[model samples]
Target: QQQVKQSPQSLIVQKGGISIINCAYENTAFDYFPWYQQFPGKGPALLIAIRPDVSEKKEGRFTISFNKSAKQFSLHIMDSQPGDSATYFCAASKRTDYKLSFGAGTTVTVRA
Candidate 1:
C-alpha cells in the first residue's frame, strides 16, 4: 500500500529545461521526505530530501520543495539533460521508522 500519491506518470523534457514532479501524502506522522532516482538495471538512489522544518532544499540541479501544512512536496530538476533520464519516486517516512511508503513513480525522459 502506498501512502504517497504522485502525478504525471511520465513526462518528456527538452535539454536545459525544467522537470517538475509533485507528490502528496495524507499521513501527518511522516517527517522524512526523499526523492529517489532510478536508472535501468540499477536501484533507486536518494537524490534530494527535505524535512517538515524546511520549505525547500536545493543541491546542485536538484531541489526539493516542501509544504508542511498541505502535506505536499515536489522535486524540481533544473537544466534537464539526457543523462538525467530516469524514474523518480517520492517517498515519505517517519524519522523513527525505517519503513517508507512510496509513490507510483514518474518516468522522465530528457530529449537531447
Candidate 2:
C-alpha cells in the first residue's frame, strides 16, 4: 500500500498549453505528498508539495490538487513552456518513514 501510481508515461504539449499528470496512492498512512522535476542530467528538484489537509496548493505556474478521501493527487502546469519539459515524479511518504514511495515518472515535452 505504499505505492504511488502515476499515469501517462509520456506527454507532448504545445507551448502555452496546460500539462497535467495524475497519481494515486493506496496507503492512508502517507501524510506528505511531493512532486519532483528532473532535467536531463541533474538530480530531481522539489517543485511543489501538499499535505493531506490541503485540498490544493499553487506556486507560480505549478499547482497540486490533492484528494484525501480518494487517495489521489495531480499536478497541473499552466502555460507550459519549453523549459518546463522534464520528467516529473509524484511521491508520498509519512513523517516516520525514512524514504518516499515514488510513482513512475511522466516525461513531458512542450513544443513551441
Candidate 3:
C-alpha cells in the first residue's frame, strides 16, 4: 500500500528555473525521507534525504524541505537543467521496519 502521496504528476520547467515536487504521508512512525531520481531505462538513484529531526537539507542544487508536524516534505531543484529531466520519487520508511512506501513518481522535463 502506498503511504506517501505526491503532487504534480508531471512538470515542465525552463532551464535555470526551480522545479519543486511535494509529498505528504500519514504515518508518524516514518523517520527516513528520501527522494530518488531516475532516467530512462535506469534505476532510481538516491538524490537527497532528510530525517524528522531536520526541517531541511540541501546538497548542491537540490534541497529537501521537510515538515514533521504536517507530515509533508518537498524537493526543490535549483537552476534546473535539461540533464535533470527525469522521474522523481518521494519515499518514506521507518527505521525499524526498513521498508519504504513510495509515492507515485513525478516526471520532470526541463526545457532548454
In terms of TM-score, how similar is model 2 to the real structure?
A: 0.97
lDDT of 1 by residue, 52-111 (tens): 999999999999999988889999999999999999999999999989899999999999
Q: Which 10-residue window of candidate 1 scores lowest in summed lDDT?
A: 1-10
- TM-score (C-alpha, index-matched) for candidate 3: 0.98
Error of 3 at 30 (Å): 0.4
Q: Residue 50 lDDT in model 1?
A: 85
Each prediction's RMSD over C-alphas, in Å, is: 0.7, 1.1, 0.7
Which pairs clash inside model 2? Answer: none
The Cα error of candidate 2 at residue 84, in Å, is 0.2
List lDDT for all candidates, in order.
Answer: 0.95, 0.96, 0.96
Local accuracy of candidate 3 as per-residue lDDT tens digits, 44-108: 99999899998999999999999888899999999999999999999999988858899999999
- Model 1 alpha-carbon miss at residue 1, Å: 4.2
Give the least accurate 10-residue stretch of model 3, judged by summed lDDT. 94-103
What's the distance in Å from true for residue 29, model 2? 0.3
